[model samples]
Target: MDLHYSPFDFAIQKDPYPVYKRMREEAPVYRNEEDDFYALSRHADVVAALKDSERYSSKNGLRLEPAFWGPQAEQIFSFVALDPPRHTRLRALVQSAFTNKRVQALEPRIREIGKAHLEPLLSGDTFDLMHFAGGFPTDVISELVGVPEADRAKVRDLGMAIMYREPDGGPVKDLPPSAMAAVGALVGYYTELTIDRAKVRQDDLLSGLLDAAEGEDRLTPEEVVSILILLVGAGIETTMLLLGNAWHAAAAHPDQKALALGGRIEDWVEETLRYDPPSQTIARTTVADVEVHGTVIPAESRILLMTGAANHDPAVFENPDAFVLGRDTAGSLAFGYGRHHCLGAILGRLEARIALEALTAHIADYEIDEANAVRIGSSNNRGFASLPTSFTAR
Candidate 1:
């Protein structure tokens, strides 16, 4: 049998499902020689690996490459990249802001921002949803988390460059010199912002973090910076991909677009997640030796959970290839499973729903400019870098 997979295949970046399908059927747990990391493609196996944190620890770090953080910095980020008591404590410190009620309270505000940004574009015949509709949430999260409006543009640029990886979902080779400079600038800006927030103390997530850090579980000042980076970086990048991908998906399917526009956007959002998840893969490292589906993975082996493949497993979802709105696969590991599941899942869903609803409701028809709509150069995230479209406003 021949297996053709690399961590930087441009073709796979455009559409990885076919390759993932082949992987799931033929090689449920495959180790790619190119990257030297093991991948789990089947839904059941991936879910089990995610849940069994003791066996599959996160301490090895989630990124495909090492040195994203220096030795000391890596230890701090390992809070998310580790298992058990540490992940639990750190996650609990920030979990309150991501609760259903907290996310629900922001829906009206999100809708308003969606309308404000989208309505102007609706009057135009065509526009790039990635810039207009998709970019709105990045700004929204920045504002909600107390990033001053003036600094958000810089934040967005830095976040996008850092998050977008190569096609095979591998980390970028290294930040360009300019990007490195931008990182320093961003860190300085956020450092000042954190100091100011400490003084003024407003009603925002950043302020909440300051207040929450009371006793032993309290986040240090540096930890606060790390969490802000995670929040702004993860929040912006994932939502941007979701909105961008959802728009592209809807433009391709008219009936589904109509259904989405007709007050059924949640179905469309869910289907989009199942069809083309933003976070295509997540990594876990084994703590103790573990055998998954007859494959013996040594302790300390890195495991990659292919969420894109897991969502399409026929044994889990009926007609896995077909995009059926409102089809509920109760066990879809789209947001992942167990302790390290996305903290902002609800916020992401709400943002996607609002963006999709606004676009479908306001635009008569839109088509993807395939000639120019490029995929973001990231292995772990799957979405367009730019989605130019022509549309008629309703």
Candidate 2:
């Protein structure tokens, strides 16, 4: 079957793997002339491209369009757009904060936050999982980044507004005034907050960023705001979608869900990430000519590393379509690989595991209303917008 991959297609959002499967087999290195980008679908291609920063340089902004790419995106997006030493330098400054020890230390607080949100929802028969999962991460991120409690609601609202991107190939800076205003609000909020945290010195990520002096390395004020926005935006939206996807996967495969409930919730988290990752595609621009599957992509070309497609590549797994418990999902591109691997992988895993365990503990089994469920669509991300579920009290 010939494949047409449109990120905005709601039909594609409904069930993208079949299309992805065809892309992997038929057109591993597919080029969409209309969209004017090259897609690398197969597991091997995607993995190689992600690690080959020299050839498929991320320096030209991660998105397709120049309006949101290049210099404009660099201003706000920080290191995701850079390559090698620059990317390495900026990453090193903040990498210590997300170390395994640090993420482990935050487990108790993650449980507390998870319980506080889920407790209220158990009172009702039906509730929106996204709504419940959304704020928990934002709250945790807010506390970590020193976002004041009083302003978290507004911050989250602004974050949601900034998160929405038009499907059209336009620059985000050219987005609607409301969206632009929300960006402005986030910039202003963080600019002031960065300055405040520098002086007060709280035990938060922002404060650590202020004083994290590894020899001569340190972050500029503007750089701090940029990274904070990147972390806050990526941290909240992706994990929020992940929590919903976990339930979406469980509802679709009852047997796997049942097996997961038998004290193996972490496997469900891993499988959910493999099946419907919160991030479907990670975009990049070629710094030089690169060849994949006998196709030569010219330098300055836009490339879409289809992490979603690669996750289900049949060559790498036994049954890519079906959800099974405890499969060997090694080399999973869900958190990505290479120089730009996800910084929050551990943190995201911790949060999702806690959320799922708590949900299963509360209601041994829950039915997801798939007919009413909505999928989150974006040029760069994928997952559910809302996953409503009902369960009898245990």
Candidate 3:
């Protein structure tokens, strides 16, 4: 097969690892002039770009969708699209809310949510784990962010639309009308939620952010709304993929599944992130001319950090394609790097760990119908839209 890479292409989406491996070995600095982006596939180059925020700035936007650039994007993205001081200021405000103690405190609730979904699935022979993956994360995040139960369904649907329309979604440049409507709906809903929470002060992350302050410096309504929108997008998508990929990996590799069954699910979870990261790519625009691997990326040009490829770079990990336990994942870029490492990293890992624990404990044996699995072609991440599986109840 040709070693072409296109996130929007379903062929590449089904199995990107082989192409990623080729990119690392053959075109370490792969260029897609047609797509208007330069891709870095090697671990050394990718990590260097990730850390050098001064040159390869995320200020343009980290999403693979180039349309999500500009002042307007920041208004909705909050700190995710900002550089240094601005990013630092906004990120610090909410840092306390996701602290170790606080995230650990949510484990009981996360476990409860995880087990609730598993027990019912245990009664059935065939089920799509994607529902559990998609539902559990949103539920936990919604409750944490104080989204009222009555409104969660509507808001969750809007969030999905805002990211990607279901059933053959179109390009970002030509987003469906419903997705466009979702864009507005999300901002309005979050704006109202932030305002209401500011007044009532509930005991949830939303209220916590409303109270997130440093003397006179506090989160403005716009900032609060932006964070809420970001939380919804980031919180659900990646965590869902993390869970989906973990189960998929376990099913594909019996050695890993045996390990998971042997109370080594944590190792499986980490290996899953490294082997198949929920987020495959991170985009940045050059603020200044930079040279990498003898390839000079010009200023104002787009750079696609091939994190998915880097996770499997042979120089970084031995037998890079294999999902083996106890592999050294110290330098894995799964949660990102430098100033933009996911703030929800702790929360995401905790959620995946608990969910994996529940699956291994309750579902004794399972096999995913990969031939018919629902694959969603996304701009930045790769994951199943539905993973139909037949399982044996424990």
Q: Sort by TM-score, best first: what order?
A: 3, 2, 1
Off by over 4 Å in 2: 65-67, 165-176
lDDT of each residue in 315-383, candidate 3, tens digit only: 889999888987889879999988888999989988988988888777778899988787766777878
The prediction achieving the highest lDDT against the true structure is 3
Task: Mark the regions of model 3 whose C-alpha exceeds 4 Å error after superposition.
Answer: 1-3, 165-174
Candidate 3 TM-score versus the reference? 0.95
Model 3 / residue 56 / CA error / Å: 1.0
**Superposed Cα deviation of residue 319, candidate 1 (Å):** 1.0
Q: CA lDDT of each candidate?
A: 0.74, 0.80, 0.82
- Candidate 2 per-residue lDDT, tens place, 110-216, comes to 89988988888878788888888887898888877878889999998888887774433332323457867888899899999988777798767788788766788
Clashes of each: 6, 0, 0
Clashes of 2: 0
